[model samples]
Target chain A: EPEVTQTPSHQVTQMGQEVILRCVPISNHLYFYWYRQILGQKVEFLVSFYNNEISEKSEIFDDQFSVERPDGSNFTLKIRSTKLEDSAMYFCASSSDSVTEAFFGQGTRLTVV
Target chain B: GIQVEQSPPDLILQEGANSTLRCNFSDSVNNLQWFHQNPWGQLINLFYIPSGTKQNGRLSATTVATERYSLLYISSSQTTDSGVYFCAVHTGGGNKLTFGTGTQLKVEL
Candidate 1:
């Protein structure tokens, strides 16, 4: 099965600095999502995007967070300013439909200092 | 939001042993997926069974949607099976996925 791919498997950034996590979703998927998992914690959904617009987002996905599909097949999550608490593994996922199976990427480990 | 609970928070088994893992959901979901997190922290999806049954090699899964539960069976597990098993559910109500705490399995060879 085809899988989603994420860049910069490991990222280390300074607090208050800006960063962008990129993903190339499955070639034929329709919906895109971003989820984060803090070490030893359950995964939490951040936002979902479809048709070039955000469909839903969790409270954790606030003004500081933004997602854009700058071009076909490429999705990105940008954090305006990083925080120490933001250190975690970020996963990207894609589904053929909103209510169906989703393929997840290996994840990008972001360490904010 | 849906509540997902996984039983047997941790397990230890000798290589070539059989084991069963369970997942219970609080509500109805359109889709459910099982994932294994390796020691390196990469999630490898094992199944995407919303209902009924599916098998792959020595692994099999069955979901009784009516009972709101799912079971994963690993026959003759090996040392490679040692990892954290997680179940995630997504209801049509929202795009967010509610995940269980996961079961940490250790297989001793």
Candidate 2:
């Protein structure tokens, strides 16, 4: 079965540095999303992208965060300056449409120090 | 926004036992899904039963949209089934899912 794929399974970055997490959603998927889970916490939604624009975003997705679909296949989340609290597992998911089952990638573990 | 609650926050079972997990939502939903987060922290898609019933091998799920709840049944549980099971729902016709507090299940030999 086709699955969502994320790059840089794990990343370590300085507190003031930038990081971009990349994902390649299923080829035919039309909606994409980004979610994060802090250690021992529930998964939290960050943002949703469709038609090269953001559909919705949470408070956690503030000024520092931005998502881009630079190409037809790549979806990326960039954080301008990492904070210690930013350490978490970031997941990328995609669905065929707005109301279908979304498939998740293995996730990229972001560690800020 | 919607609230999702999962029952029996934690469960322990011996191999070959049977178990059931339940999820309740506060409002009508457009999508309901069950996911398993393994020890390695990978979210595995188990079921996508927005309504009605779906069965895959020893696992089955039923969602009653009107009642606003869903149930997941695991028969002949194995050690491999040990993981945190989560129920998530999307309400008001959007793609963002609100996740319920998970039920952590541990199956021992």
Candidate 3:
């Protein structure tokens, strides 16, 4: 079965530095998303991307966050300046359509110090 | 925004036992899915039952769209079933999935 794949299973960055989390969703999927989970908290939606544009974003996806589909296969989330509170597990998911079963990647653990 | 609530925030079960986890949503949804987050923190898709019932091996799920609730049944659970189960829904008019609080299950031998 084809699955979503994320790069750099774990990352450590300075509090004021930038970080880019990359994901390659399933080959034929059309809709992509980014979600984060703070330790011991529920998974929260960040943003959804389709047709090279963001469809919807949550409050957590503020000015510091941006997503890009620079190529046909890569979806990335960039944080301009990381904060201690930004530490969490970031998951990338994709689906064939808005109403289809979305599959998730293993997740990238972002730790800011 | 929609509210997703899961029952029994935590559970402990012995190997070979059976259990049911429930999820309730505040509004109608276009899609409903069940996922298991293992110790490695990977969200594994278990089911995508927006309505009706579907079974996959030891796991089965049922969603009643009109009632706005979904149930996940685990039969003859094993130690490998220990993890956090999350129920997520795609509310009408939105493309993002809203995840529930999750139910943490620990199965011991």
Candidate 4:
């Protein structure tokens, strides 16, 4: 089965540094999303992308975060000046449409020191 | 915004035992999905029961959209089934999924 693939299974960055997490969604998927889960916390939605633009974002998705579909197959999330609280598992997901079931990637573990 | 509540935050079952997990949502949803986060933290998709019943192998799920609740049944559980089960729902027309608190199940041999 086709799946969403994320790069760098784990990453460790210093505070105030920048990090980019990349994902390649399923080829035929039309909607892409970025979500994060703090240790022992709920999975939180960060942003959703469609048509090469951000369709919606949550309050947690502030100025420090940005997402881009740099190419037809690559979707990326960039966090500028990482904070200690930013340490979490970031998941990338995609779906055929906005309302369909989305498939998730294995997730990228981001650790900020 | 919608609220999702999962019952019995934790459960312990012996191998070959049966279990039922429940999820309750605060509002109507356009999509309802059940996912299992394994010990290694991989979110595995189990079922996408929005308003009906679907069974796969030893697992089955039923969602009553009007009632705003869904149930996941695991029959003859195995140690491999040990994981945290989460029910996620998308309300309104948004693409974001709001996840429930999760039910942690540990099936021991």
Q: Best by lDDT, which number?
A: 3
Model 4 / residue A6 / CA error / Å: 0.4
For all predicted structures, in order, the TM-scores are 0.98, 0.98, 0.99, 0.99
Q: For model 1, name the residue pairs that clash.
A: none
Q: Write the per-residue lDDT of candidate 1 for residues B1-109, one digit (tens) a residue.
A: 7899998899999999999999999998888899999998888989999999999999999999889999999999999999999999888778877789899999998
The alpha-carbon deviation from the true structure for residue B109 of candidate 3, after best TM-score superposition, in angstroms, is 1.0
lDDT score of residue B47 within candidate 4: 94
lDDT tens digits by residue: candidate 2, A1-113: 99999988999999999999999999999999999999888899999999999999999999999999999899999999899999999999999998889999999999999
Arrange candidates by DockQ, descending: 3, 2, 4, 1
lDDT of 4 by residue, A1-113 (tens): 99999988999999999999999999999999999999988788999999989999999999999999888899999999999999999999999998899999999999999
Candidate 2 on B11-100: residue-level lDDT in tens?
A: 999999999999999999989999999998999999999999999999999999999999999999999999999999998756798899
**With candidate 2 superimposed using the best TM-score fit, by how many Å does residue A48's alpha carbon deviate from the native?**
0.3
Q: What tens-digit string does per-residue lDDT give for candidate 4 at B1-109? A: 7999999899999999999999999999989999999987889999988999999999999999999999999999999999899999998777899999999999999
- Summing lDDT over every window of 10 consecutive residues in candidate 2 chain A, give the lowest-scoring window: A36-45
Segments in model 4 whose C-alpha atoms lie over 4 Å from true places: none
Indicate the worst ten consecutive residues by lDDT in candidate 4 chain B.
B90-99
**Scored by Cα lDDT, where does model 4 land?**
0.95
Residue pairs that clash (backbone atoms under 3 angstroms), model 4: none
